[model samples]
Target: MAGHSKWANIQHRKGRQDEKRGKVWTRIIREITVAARQGGADVTANPRLRLAIDKAKAANMPADRIKYNVDKASGNLEGVNYEEIRYEGYGIGGAAIIVDTMTDNRVRTVAEVRHAFSKYGGNLGTEGSVAFQFKHCGQLVFAPGTSEDKVMEVALESGAEDVVSDDDGAIEVITSPTDFEAVKNALEAAGLVADMAEVTMRAENTIAIAGEDALRMQKLLDVIEDLDDVQNVYHNAELAE
Candidate 1:
């Protein structure tokens, strides 16, 4: 990840979200429903639900729409039941990938996922195949030129685990999943707003792939992400912007 700033990676993800803006609401609603159903509707008692709501707000989802989905999933109203699934695989150049999905039909979901992998220059692997290469945690990445000292001070005071400044000038604050909200709030209060903040499966290491290989790998990822049941896509490949 040397030449690529952490903020660059965040922008890549944001760019992908923008490209699929039409489906953003659909994805957020599914996430809200699933999080609520699994952990109950009380945001205070349910960290997962709270995170889902945070994403909804970031996507500009309406307050009433968010609450309706939460209540519906909590059984206060009617909603579709979803089951979470994780698919691991190798992309072009053996880049590791993990796809997180929530679906009512595992049959259709798996078929579509497997088909997408096969359609591209990749192969879906067994459970835990690429998962071992990732760590589930909360990550807050600041844009290049942000004040590293201030970010470090506020993040540490707010329960962040580590703060690192990339050679390229992006600052990253890592925290345990449960402590993410507090750290993010503290940093924002301190005027150190992050470019990206989320509970994510971050790659412990990276694989750099460029040229045609990079293009193919990105296509594989985009296809997997476009699936209706897919919630998130994580990969170790750092492609050129």
Candidate 2:
């Protein structure tokens, strides 16, 4: 697997416990609220809300808490209003980075984000600066030991766009964002469970960074991710393992 994938796996595992748990919940709650506000409280009729609910369930969030947020956002109760924002930037070695946020305070969010970039050896860029380097899609990755042939067969038959096996034996299935839930359900019905699956901004290409540059880039990413308003951080940097 590429170092970026490895790093993502590490973060995924680590995010479930300790201080990161609360941060994870905060981000998920924001997502659920936004999804509900945009669509509706009914998961079956709202794909975005359904995805957010799935993430909440995976994180072991209480059903009542999840419902409360949805109800509040759907106007059953008063709630804070938030706006979605996307910030593009450059990391170590000029690698492209994109930060997604939902905030009630745009000025505060922007300042904190800009400070994080400048403090971490990165430069904040204008809109569309680095977003062109990514494709919005749904991706599912299976471990090295998984059966690639079976995955390919099932995925392609179930509305998947592509199936690719990396050098490290990881199999990735790509799908349109709209087809993500359907494809995922089909895979589960076929007894295939992914190690990682999500709708994301997938990088089209990567910048390889090593040694000191890699360390700095990791630090930059960490700071950006730690920001309260930052919901998701995507980058095109492949760090040295």
Candidate 3:
């Protein structure tokens, strides 16, 4: 598995704990609000909203809460206006990092992000600073017991770029953003259930950071992700097991 995949696995494990604390529901609600605001309240017609709703449902977010947030986003109720932003930076040991956020105030969000990086021995960079070092790809993960060869065959047939089997017993499929839904549907039709699916920024190359640098990188990621405005953190830090 790649660093991104490793980080995702870590998050999944931590997410259960987050759920108990109600943090997962907050994040899911933010995503739902943003998605509905951007693409309207119709889940069937709004792909982004559809995905967010699916995630919310999977997380066991209450149906009434989901509807409330969707209504808030669609102007049926009052809510904060959010703008999506991406921050590119470098973490300890020069590992490239990308932070995705949805905030009502861009100035406050950027300052908070910059402060976290600088405090953690990292530096915030200009736009496109480290983006070129990564590839924006669609990822769909399948759990263990799914036939790898069968899954790979369907993914490739549905325009996926690659299928990689990991030691964690999960299979990760890569595809272009436009082909993601099709590829996912194909796999599902073949009796494969996707554990997680998202369009993510994947590092084309990664840096192996050990000891102090690795610890610093994790702290930086935690700081960024703990921000209420931040949604996702992508980095090239090769987290050791």
lDDT of each: 0.88, 0.89, 0.83
List TM-scores for all candidates, in order.
0.95, 0.94, 0.89
Clashes of each: 0, 0, 0
Q: Write the per-residue lDDT of candidate 1 for residues 1-241, one digit (tens) a residue.
A: 2334456667887987988876888888988898888889999999889888998998888899899999899999977778989999999999999999989999999999999999998899999998999889899988888988888889999999888777678888889988999999999899887888899998988898889898898899889999999989999998866
RMSD of 1: 1.7
Off by over 4 Å in 3: 1-21, 143-145, 166-169
**In model 3, how large is the Cα lDDT of residue 55?**
79
Clashes of 2: 0
Question: Residue 22 in candidate 1 has what lDDT?
Answer: 68
C-alpha lDDT of candidate 3 relative to the true structure: 0.83
Model 3 lDDT per residue over 55-89, tens place:
78887888998999999989999999888899999
Q: Which stretches of candidate 1 lie over 4 Å from their true place?
A: 1-4
Off by over 4 Å in 2: 1-19
Predicted model with the maximum TM-score = 1
lDDT tens string, model 2, 1-241?
2323443443444553345888999999999999999998988899999999999998899999999999999999999999999999999999999999999999999999999999989999999999999999999888888998899899999999988776667788889999999999999999999877899998888788999998899889989999999999998887775
Q: Least lDDT summed over 10 consecutive residues: which range in candidate 2? A: 1-10
